[model samples]
Target: MLLAIDVGNTRIKAAVFEANTLFDAFIFVKEEFAEKIEIILQQHPKITTMVVASVGNLDPSAFSSFEKRTKIEFISHKTKFPFQNLYATPNTLGIDRMVLAAGAVLQFPKQNRLIIDAGTCITYDFVDADDRYLGGAISPGITLRYESLHHFTAKLPLLTKSYPENFIGNSTTESMHSGVVNGVISEIDSFIENYKTRYAKFIIILTGGDADFLAKRLKNTIFANSNFLLESLNQTFQYNQK
Candidate 1:
């Protein structure tokens, strides 16, 4: 068994994998990570190797407990990836995005892929058919948009994201919903359109916290999987071994 951990901006998502199949999964806040991992370890002592990918400033001590039982691999720019990274500032690339790009290549090979991860922030990462990690864009995520409005202004109340009934919102809360939700949909669609113009045939893989909410709303066809990063972490682990 393999243990995979993806520490994102807000949460730490961990999974136990038997080869490519997911055995079990759990998520917790960053502060609770060490305790959660301890529980997971107690439950699955057979996990021989662990791979971690983080975009947050997680303390290394949190993972120190795994040293005795599992071989830990924390992904970094130095880590071997399946694809050639062409980003100008390679060192500055987020490990989460790198893992997602690697996941795209592993999941759907020999094709142009655009991976949209909608978590704390929305990130678009592209990997061409030739297996080159071409850079993509990033924008404010659904929650961030709502929070930004409230944080930046005094009167606007902080609202949770929801699917608006119409583009023309009737109420104050609905208007915020319309702007954030529909605006994201439009932004994603526009990115897809622009990518299509450049690449004749490609696949869009949408995965993240808000993937389910945005999947049906998207005009472009996409393969949505919320646990993509974890899966990719496992794949990267296997690839690293080879």
Candidate 2:
């Protein structure tokens, strides 16, 4: 059995896997180390290999303690990844992003792939069928778009990022929502439009917190798997083990 943990800026997701099949998982928000991990250890005592991809300030000491207690080694950025890393700064690359590319490779084994992770930030990564990571692009998410407007302007209140009443907004709140959500839709459309000119028939995979929120809003069709990063973690762990 294997244990994969993905620690994001706002929350943490941990999943148990058995022979390439995910078992159970849990989501933990930002909180001090309580008995939560201890409980997890007890629940999956058979988890022989542990992998952690953290985007936050994760203490190595805690994972070390798990190693000592569960007799399982931890997989990290230091762990060898299977694909050829093309990122200019490998050390600076986010683990979540790496896992995502790995996941894309496994899911669409022989096809060009594009992964769009829409969370606190939106990241666009691509991988070739030969397992070449072509790198990715990143930008502020919808919420950040709203927050930026408020921060940049004096009277513009911090509007929530959601679907607009209509594309043609007739009010302030509606206009803000339209700018954030509809803007994202158009931005994605433009990216796809350009990418299509370069690559023919690359599969588009979308995931992350804001994925569902804007999945239907997308102008172009996309495959949405909210647990993509976790699946990627599992694949990465297995790849390193072999």
Candidate 3:
């Protein structure tokens, strides 16, 4: 059996996979994380492989200690090039982004694909037909944009709700909400239009926190996966074993 983990800025997720099938998965929060991680690993003592992807470079020493306790193979790359090196400086590209796009390419090979992750930040990544992970764009997520406005500025207050009204805003809060969500919707629309012009029959995939929220608003159809990075870790495990 293989255990996969994706560490984001705010949470950590775990999945147990056997025979290329996911058995179970859940999110372990930070408040009582050490106990939760220990319990999860204790129950799955026979796991032979462990794969991980993180938004930021987590201290590998911490993970290494856990792997030593579990007797499982740990896989993580700070600078390893999994796919063709296209970026000018491969070290700057986030491993989470690489895993996410590579997983999509594994699922849908020989096709142009767009992966939009809407979490701490919204990222758009493209994989060309050649299987090269061409880079895309990144923008503030719905919540972060709201929080940034309040945190960075003096007058603006923080917001948690969303607006489904027309583009124009009526009040100060609505004005901010409209600008964030509506602006993203337009941004995605324009991106899709530009993608379609270059590639024929491209597949669009959306993931991360606000994927469902944004998908509901955008007219462009997308395949929504909540555990994209988990699937990517699974794929990465298989790739390394081969």
C-alpha lDDT score of every prediction, in listed order: 0.93, 0.81, 0.77
- TM-scores of the candidates are 0.98, 0.89, 0.88
Residue by residue across 32-138, what tens digits does model 1's lDDT show?
Answer: 88788889989998998888998987987787877988898889989999999999999999999999999999989999999999999999999999999999999
Q: Write the per-residue lDDT of candidate 3 for residues 56-100, one digit (tens) a residue.
A: 445556565575555444444543334564776667878778888
**Strongest candidate by lDDT:** 1
Give the lDDT of residue 102 in candidate 3.
77
What stretches of model 3 exceed 4 Å from their correct place? Answer: 43-45, 71-82
lDDT of 2 at 214: 77
Q: After superposing candidate 1, which stretches have Cα over 4 Å from the reference?
A: none
lDDT of 2: 0.81
Candidate 3 global TM-score: 0.88
